[model samples]
Structures are given as C-alpha cells and as structure tokens.
Target chain A: MQRLVVLPTSRTGWALTIAFVAVVVAGIWPVIDLVNRAVLFLGLPLLVVWSYVLIFACFAVMLIANRVIEWQEGEDD
Target chain B: MTSPWPLLITLTYVAIAMVIGLRARGGRRMNSLEEWGVAGRSMGPVTLYLLIAAGSVSAYTFMGAPGWAYAKGVAVFYVAVYLAYLALVAWYFGPKVWQFGEQFGHVTQASAIADRYQSPALGALAALVMSIGSIAYAVLQTVGSAYILFVMSGGMIPVWLGVPLVLGCIAIYLFVSGQRAIGRTNAFQGVLMLIVAWAVGMWALHNATGGLRFGPLFERLLAEHGEFLTLPGAGGDMTFSFWTTSIIVSMFSFMPPVWTQWMSASSARTIRRSATWLPTYYVVILPMVVVGFIGIFSLPDLARADTVVLEYAMQHLPVVLVGLLGAGTLAASMSSSEPFIHSVALSWSRDVLQPLLGLSDALTGRLARWMIVPLMALVIAPLAIAEPGSLVMILLVGLGFATQVLPAFIGMFFWPRASRLGVMAGIVAGFLVTVAFTTLWPHPLGVHAGFWGLMLNLPVFVAVSLVTAPADSEVVERFFRIAAPRGLTRLGSGGKTVAADTAAHGG
Candidate 1:
C-alpha cells in the first residue's frame, strides 16, 4: 500500500500523470515558438492562444483527477 | 489639480471592506491556533476559492504585471501561464497538505515539515526563511497600498498616512477575526478586482480603438511594433530560457500564506475543487495585460512602466471609473497583505516561539495576536516607510529562496528514502546558490538563478540521502497512510489499513 501510494497504482492515475507532465513540458520548453510567428489565431496572438489552451487543458485534467478521487472514496465507503 | 472625489470613493470602499471583515467573526471566539490560524478548518470551496485567488493576485497584478506588458510584450504572458500552472500544483499538493494538517494538528507548513523530518530546528529554519520572505512581501504590499492611495488622492494622503491607513485596517480585523476576516474580505476584494479588471479593459478598448474590440488593437500593435508581439520581447532581454525558468520558479515556490489557506479548508475535496476552478479566475489578467498593450500606442514613452495603467486611466477615464480603479487596486493590495501579515505572526508563534519555549496552544495564540502589531509597526511599516529601492531586489531574492523548500516538500510527500540531514543540506546549499546567482551573477546564461540553485540542490539532496540513514519505517508508513490514504477509509482513523480495519470490525 505504501509503495503503491507513492506511484500511480491504476491506469487512470498513470494517464493523468502523463498528461500533466506533457502540459508542463509544453509550457516551459519553448514549444510555443513553433506557433509564435507574428500572426493571430482566434483573434489573438498564437502564443497567447496557446497559453489559454493550456489553461483549458489544465482545467480538464484536474477535473478528471477530482472525479476519480471521488469515485475511489465512494468505493472505499 | 486632482479631484478629491476619487479619494472619497476609495475611503468609502475601505470603510465597506472593514465592515465585511469585522462581521466575518460570525460570533465565534477565535481562541485556539486551529481556529484563528485556519478559521477552525471550516471554509467551503467557494470561500476558499476567493481567499486563495484574491490573496495570490496582489498589487503585482494591478501594477507590475501591466508594467511588464508595457515594457516586454509576450514575456508578460508568462504571468498568466505560470499562474494557471499554479492551480494545477495546488490541485495536486493542497489536498495532501490539508490531510497532514488535519491528522497531525499541523496549522503551519513548518510544523508539518518538522514533524515529517523529526527536526524542530529544521522547522525553525523554515519558519525563519518563510517569515523573512513573508515580511518582505508584506512590506512591498504595504508600500504598494500607500502608493495607490497617494497617487489616487493626488498625494494628499502621503505615504506615512497611507501606510497605516491600509495596514491598520488589515491589522484591526486580523487581530479580531483572524483568518475569517481574510476569507470574507478576500471574497469581496476578489469580486471587485474581477469586475474592475473587465470594466477597465472594455472601457480602455472602447476609447482607444474607437470600438470595444481587441482585434484592431492587436493589428495596430503588430503592424507598428512587431518585435513586442513574441518571445524575448521588445528589448530582447527576456530570452526563452529566462521566460521558462521564471515560470518554473514562480510555479513551484511555496508561499507560506497560501499554506494557511489550504489548512483552512473544510475537506480535502474542497481544496481540490477550489484548485480545479482557479485557472478561470486568471482570465482577469487578460484584460489587465490588454490595458498594458493599450499603453504601448495610446500613451508612449512612459518614464516608469509600472504607472502606465494608472496614467492612462487618469488621463482618459471618468472620475467614477478612476475611483473604482483605486478601490480595486486597494482591494488587491490589502487582500494579499492581510493573509501574509497573519501568516507571519501565526508561524512565528506556532512554529518558532512555541517550539523554542514549549508554550501552550492558548498562549501561542495570544502571542500570535500580540506579535502582529510589532511586526507591522516596527518591522514592515518602517521598512515600507524607508521605501529603499533595494527592497524590491531583496523581495525577488526572498522569492527565489522559497523554491529551495521543494526538497523538503518532496521528502514529506514522497520519496520515503529522503533523510532529514539530506533535506537540510539540500535547502541550505540551494539557498546559498540561489543568493549567489541572483545577487552576484544574476540569471547566468539566460536561465533563472533559482533554477540553477535547484539544479545543484537535487543532486546534493540525492547524494546526502544515499549516505544518511532513512527515518523509521513505521513512522514513514504512517505518514504515507495519512498523506495518500488511497485504500484507507478516512483521514481521522489513526492510519489503519483497510484490510486490518475491516477484519477488526468483524467483516
């Protein structure tokens, strides 16, 4: 139990972890430069558009994580 | 000459905030450290949301962020990006921290770290570092609050008077209502700032572009000064490495005021819910950044970049809107200041003085209240009054120092092999490296000095832990049970495994 607690024991946990890591990497690795040319996407700069997209991604990931936790807690009950 | 109407409206706003804060007491006597420091752990998701959101957005959001946007174009978007990432961090870590607090009676981060490492002295060290950072930050906010009033009042209020006026209101409610005051006032402040941010943004867009739209503004900006639209910004100073490293440092560095907010949650679910929704609140930064971009063409050649938003507003907006802007900025300043000042006092009493003297909880709570006055009047107020130019630089270094706690956090939450000695060595070495790079060399090779410090810190931590003995397995397991509790039923069940608990219950 102790070991599994530290590492993700379930597939959902692993998927969330990978998604979160991808988000962090895309955020800080100059990946935005690929889309950072002097152009607008969705009425804003591409870089700015990418930032809000990441924000939306973050919200989606956390929402899923929270729902999983709720399900796990209910199962325990 | 500036009209006193703005000042009068701001004062009226202050009076309303005071009423809300005092009324947040809700007829409870805040006697214990748990009650006062963390509002008896009764805050729901909404209140917690407002408290954390408002406290995180400070005078920086009002002034410095826009200042960055005015000076460096896309680089300022890093604020929005990192802040969004911070919500993800809070989502992951906040629940675990709340569980530790609930299980072990840990109101302060230092106490939790101390218990995890079995080192009161390390807790003392954390308390000192966190307090210095908190106080320096509070001083900046106090100075900012005073500056807001001084500017909005056309210098009629003066810094000396404005400092006490803003800090004094916080102190009164903090002394009486404690975290409850912060929770309520922050909610009011959060709503106000959000409204003001959107209102000011739309108004600026309408007046400047002759229409209420951002497309034309972006077109004009890209057409005229295209360099400001991308990375490394207009001056070509904020490189990609610098931008990325800054976001990483700001995202990971644990602000102690935020910890107290986490502990004040009613349940781990509340913490998770609040963190999940927090990124949406960061949309407020979009308009404020727009206001900064508006300044690029509308009011150019500003001597001080930070004053661009205020200067533009005063020059262009009506008296009522200007007054609303002043109230919103003041709310931003005071909302953040209250929690920081309260945490400094709470940590000093509970983590520092209480442990050193072995004082009772009641006495510690009393001492925390007493310390607030001297903390503000003697330490923070004086430093803010001096307003030395170097303090901002020092504040930045203090923030850098905070990221050094990452190793200790890892030890508490994961990596059962992490030793107390290893954590201590890593933090001390990390802090020194951070100071050296930030002060002496300053962001060498375009990477943030704090990131460099962490680079050295992780290896040292691993090396020391490999050599040093690990903590007791049973105690470590107990912590894991409480922190993760994946298969366990409840946090308050004394760390029992589900199998054993079910069998013991005759299942």
Candidate 2:
C-alpha cells in the first residue's frame, strides 16, 4: 500500500495565504461594523485604491515568485 | 426625426471590420491548423494584453455594470472586486495551462486537460459543457447588442433586425480570419470603447452636478435615494445573504470561454505579463458606476433600472456623444460575441469532433470554421424571440459553470494524486449542490450557493482522491515537471524523451 503523506507548505505560500486572509478580514470588518460611515469616509476611496493596488500586488507577487522559482530551478538543473 | 449619422458611423465600423478580415488573407500562407486557429501563436505582448482584456469585458461591462449599479447601488462594486481576483487567479493558473498548451500542441483548454489526464472522455465532456455555456453567453451578447440598437433607434430598428445584423457581421469575420480577426478587432474596439466610456461618463457627471467630483453627487444621491446607495435594510432585496452570494459569483468570473484567450497566448510569460495590466481595464467600468450614480439622483422615478445609462445619455449628453455611446455599446457587444463564437467553434472542432471522429487537424479546423455561422444563428434567433433575463442572472449562470470546473482545475494544478474519478465526482456533486441551493432556497445562510458548492467540492475532491490510489506516478510527475518546471524555457518542450528514458530504467 502506498503511504499517504501530506505535503509541507512553503513559508512563502503560508505567509501569502495568511496575509491575504488578514487583509480581507480587515477590509470587511469595518464594512460590517459601520456601514454608512464606512461608505462615506473610508469605503469608496479605499475600495477604489484597493481594487487597483491589491490586484496589481497580487499579480506582481505571482509573477515574481514564478520567475524566482524558475530561476532557482534553472540553476539547480 | 432620427439622425443618420449614428447608423453611418456604426456601419462604417462594421465595414472596417469586414475589410480587415478579407484583407488578412493576402499576407500569410495558411499551411497548418495552428495558423488557422491561433494565428500561428504569434501574438506579441501588446496585442495579447488587449485581446485578453477585450475578451473579458463585454456588453456586461457596457450596459450590465451600470444597470447593476442603478439597481443595486454600492453592491455593484463587487463586480470590480471580482474582476481584480479573476486577473490574479489567471496570473497563477494561466501560465501552467499555457505551458501545457505549448508542450502538447493544445488548441483548447479541454485538449490540455485530456492530454494531461489521458482521458479523452473527460476532454469531450469538458468541451460539451463549455460549448453549451459559451452559446448561452454568446446569445446574451447578441441580445444585449440588439437591446442597445433598439434603444438607439428609438424602436425603429426591430429586435429581430439587431441580432441577425450584428451576429452576421461577427460570423463573417470569425469565419474569415479566425484569431487574427478577433485580435485586431478586439484591439480596435477596446480602445474606442474605453475612450467613449470615459467621454460619456465625464459628460454625464458634468451635466448632472456641474463637475466631475463625486462630492456633490454623493450628497444628492444620499438625500434623494438613501436606500439605493446603501445595502438593503430589513426586508429589502440586498440582504447580507445576497451580498455574500454576489461576492462568490463574482469570484468565478475568470473561468469561462472568454478566458480561452489566455490559453491561446503565444507563451507562458506573455500570459503572466498580460494579467498584471488587465485589471487596469476595470477603470473603464468606473465611468459606468458614475453614470449609475447620476441615474439615481437625476431620474429617480424611472421604471426599468437597466435603462438608466442609456436614458441618461440620451437626455443629458450631446447628440454626437450619444451616437458615440451607441457605437461604443455596439463595440462592447461585438467584441465579446466574436471571440465567444470563435471559442465555441474551437471547443466543438478541437475537443469534440477530432476526438470522437479521429479527424485530421486540418479537417477539424475547417469544420470549426464552418460551424460558426450555424452557431451564431442558433444563439441569435432564440434571444431575439425571447429576451433573456437580467444580464446579472445570465452572468451568474455562466459563473455557475466556472464553479463546476474550479474543483477540477484546482485538483489538476495543486493535487497530484487527484484522480479522474475524484475530479468527476467533485464536479457533479458541486454542480448539483449549487443548483439545489440556488434554486431551492436563497442560498444556504448568506453565501452564494456557488461558493458553498465550491467549498464542498474541494473537500470531496480531496477525500475522494485520497481514497482512490494515486494516478500513475510518471504521469503525475510529468504534470508537475511541466507545471513547475526546473527550467522555465524547457517547460513546454515535450517530455517524451524524459518519460522514455525513465521507463527504460527507473529514475
């Protein structure tokens, strides 16, 4: 019988997943707690900037990580 | 007394599209299926970026976005938020698919899946599902274009005239130049639509509140229709549940026939690089939100919420701008429809016909090209007769298909042990659960049924894969080596030599 083994998560992966979850929670907490206030003072502009920045950062990180992994792998090969 | 200028401009655009398609025949020798289907996989970064962006933003962006905003206030921002994540997901998943496509000479997503899994049946099933979903999506685009024409002509142009005319143009272009036609037309439409959207938005904002700033407009909207601007209060339609479901639906926006454009990228890096800038295209939709905001304050008593953008443009903007807006909306509809027509054709020809009949690539490609006209007729004819539901509902149904495919995609990427059985079970179970929840009740708890289905699908997929023995080790390793290759440039090169060497003597 083949042994069932769980793969270890990489540090970068763990950190990224945690950071993404944290940002989402932080963003949503205020929306839940202060609905109207959030819309007026924080939500609109925050959402607009968040839409652009977060998406850009996410793609940037993925691209960078892929490139780094590929570079390292190439060196090893 | 309708002006002929708008019709003239639109006709000119169509004429130009046809000219590009017909003119493309002279430049290149079409020897192989690749040239016919994927433009020899020769797209550069800029064309790739524009094509991918235009493929994703459709009539949904032009009319549906502002319509949703007019109907559902701040909740519509979820669409933008979803688009952001969709690009990110594409950034991650797209490269691997592109790598596989390059290595195996894959022409469609199903081709890659079938090749990796060694299952023709799975590939055929995927093709069937995507084809049905794409036709539904194409029909929606056709209907949207017709609706726009109906609005622009002030009912002079029949709905029947709108669908056939627009679809006829799309069919002719797609049949003539294939991906080349789509790429050039998309780039043209993408730029013009962005300019026109910005112009209409600025003009609407200026006319409504005397400037582009949102301060005055926001205050006015709050004073006039406070509830519309915020989440629904008790007993209102925009409950916590609806908001959560909307978010979930938004997440699956990236996984459709439209995303087939990502699969056809010239290289993995091209796909990755394009993902970075595609979200910036979402800025084009910000104008729609502005238009919706104007609608709320300016025309509070309008009966149908979906007409807010068009109605506002008609009343407030100059006639020339209105004409431009009409052209822009038509561009949005056609931009989406043509690619979808091409994708559905590819799905049928490459995925279903070739596998089932063992036809040559050339024969299949010819069949695919011929298939577009009939498929266009099939979609447009029905949509003209019976107007489909709201664009949001149509979009959600499309997302449901994506959700069904998500488990399979996730398994293929991250979980090497995930068997075909596991994948199939997860898809079937997830799809049924989503349908049951979405239809039987207002999605269990607050979340969208699709999200819950996805949430359930992952675990079932994992458990089933675990229960089943892992797939052949060589196959799994080959997928990993291709997906996360040791040498990036070597990723798509066939691993036949490696597999053979390993087979002769164990690695």
Model 2's CAPRI class is incorrect
The TM-score obtained for chain B of candidate 2 when compared with the true chain B = 0.90
Q: Per-residue lDDT of B1-507 in model 1, one digit per residue for the tens?
A: 268878888888899999998999999887788888999999999999999999988988888888888998877888888988999989988998898899889999899888888888989899899777788899998998999899888988899999988888889888889999999999999999999989988899899989977889889888998887888898798888988899999998998888899999999999999999998898888888888999998778899898888998899998888888899999998998899899999998998999899999999988988789999999998899999888877887888889988988877666666778999899889989999998899889999989999999988987897788766666566676655455432224444434322322322
lDDT of 2 at B302: 81
Top DockQ model: 1
Q: Report the lDDT tens digits of candidate 2 across residue range B30-74.
A: 434576567777676778777877777888777777877777776
Cα RMSD of all models vs. native, in order, equals 4.3, 5.0
Docking class of 1: acceptable
Q: What's the distance in Å from true for residue B308, model 1?
A: 0.5
